[model samples]
Target: MRTRTTLAAAGLLLTLTACGGDTDDKPSAPPSLTEEQRASARAAAGLPPEPSTTARYRFLEALNDIDRRIVDGKDGKDDKAVSRGLNQCRSIKNAAGDEDKQVALVQQTLSRFTIDTRLPDIATPETGGEILAAVHKNLCPDF
Candidate 1:
């Protein structure tokens, strides 16, 4: 469970850079996971990787960075971060399946991000538990 939670947090950091938006001179290459690492990730998430788990991991790292920026109160970073995170999040959601169980998994993950990071309240959520609850409420009210 702990491993899965950590992977979920990492997944949030998965970013647009993995989506071919790098501005560097050299094109970025996807990372290859070792058998142990891949098995750990699979066991953690209890789901096999899509065709692009490397991209997902990179995206999670990026999201983690953006989340730090948000915590630091960087100007105009929230919008960009949230937009990008939401995009990856939607991909995650779609991959997980559009069902109540899937929504619960996402809810677990959002809570894990806050708990694992010890993030201070910054928005209408007002508290970590509330943040998770509100995200669960707003993101998938039907569930």
Candidate 2:
């Protein structure tokens, strides 16, 4: 009788443990883009290399730089960094061909720029919208 009771309790405990544990059945998310991949994409697209340092490719580069900085956790104490970057990005509305390609690259980079671990939970949505608005203004200023 004692042996049977011990076996039944052990079986019940095993069943409970199995039911409470997580399953390995779900698929994991894809890996994120590497710095080299991002740089290559920007270079192949003829966009500015650092985005933030130069004013010749002003608009697009600024956007790319700002996005890169924010995503790379380099956004410093300057609040105007975002606005300044956006302003530069907004300045290239009339560019054509390679210039336009760079602008498009900026737009693409911004579109893919994710704030996942860098931003505060409450500020993420608003910041993203602001970035999107900046991109929109650059792409289509009149709207």
TM-score of each: 0.28, 0.25
Best by TM-score: 1
* Candidate 1 lDDT over residue span 14-110, tens digit each: 7534665646768569999898898688546533333244443444344444345333446765444343333334435454555665545444444
Task: For candidate 2, write residues 1-143 as lDDT tens digits.
Answer: 99999999999999998887567767689988898988787555544344343332343444455454553435542334444444434333334446555545444333444344444352354555455555544433442
Q: What is the TM-score (0 to 1) of candidate 2?
A: 0.25
All models: lDDT? Answer: 0.45, 0.49
Summed backbone clashes in each candidate are 8, 1
* Predicted structure 1: lDDT: 0.45
Model 2 pairs in collision: 59-88
Looking at model 2, residue 31 earns an lDDT score of 85
